[model samples]
Target: MANAERRYSKDHEWVRVEGNEAYIGITEFAQDQLGDIVYVELPEVSSSVEKDEVVCAVESVKTAADIISPVSGTVIAINEELADQPEMINEDPYSAWIMQIELSDPTELGELMNAAEYATYCENEE
Candidate 1:
């Protein structure tokens, strides 16, 4: 499960909102499933993305996966540190956010699932 305050997407991304900007990353469960992360292809800073769109890509020992945006927004920042230490996400997915977005429609956050709800949803998916 993700941190209680973070919202989750069906695609396994997590969104931690702060004012109009939100940090986005794959959930711990997703990282665990991915095994060791090797590289990440982050969206260009200032790139506009729509909710549910593929905003980034993560490569792991097991497979490569697309990281979908949970909210429509412009990418304002990306974690450059991940380029040197992609495995950081495997160690701490929540703290190792991939990008920060300036929301185009903050109301899209309401469409996300809370921790408990996501946990249940994940369980049912398996």
Candidate 2:
């Protein structure tokens, strides 16, 4: 696993950049709140995604939620492992990333909060 800086969004998504590509997944806090994950629908490879767009959908036992894109780019790859074992998400959200994207604007990362700020933001959520 590469070193991933936990930058986040108000929508409960996390973005971690490596080189010019970005890896994305929901936080552990989010998966825990959602309960057991049964399926994942990742964005098609090469599809363009805009920031805040619904890039994928995660289906838990109770509900299906969109995994919004935190930064815009072309989706280069997806985690095929999740399709076979969605519980991997429940076990480790960060490791079970939904997709990898080639960011259109790397600077967009500066706009997101760091781990501490994201934790504080989560606490302030309703």
The candidate maximizing TM-score is 1
Winner by lDDT: 1
Q: What alpha-carbon RMSD in Å does predicted model 2 have with respect to the real structure?
A: 2.3
- What lDDT tens digits, residue by residue, belong to model 1 across residues 14-102? 99999999999999889988999999988899999999888789999879999989999899999999998999999999999999999
Evaluate residue 4 in candidate 1 and report its C-alpha lDDT on the 0 to 100 scale: 88
Per-prediction TM-score to the true structure, in the order listed? 0.97, 0.93
lDDT per residue as tens, model 2, 60-126: 9899999888999999999999889999988888888889999999988988888888877777874
Taking all chains together, the TM-score of candidate 1 against the true structure is 0.97
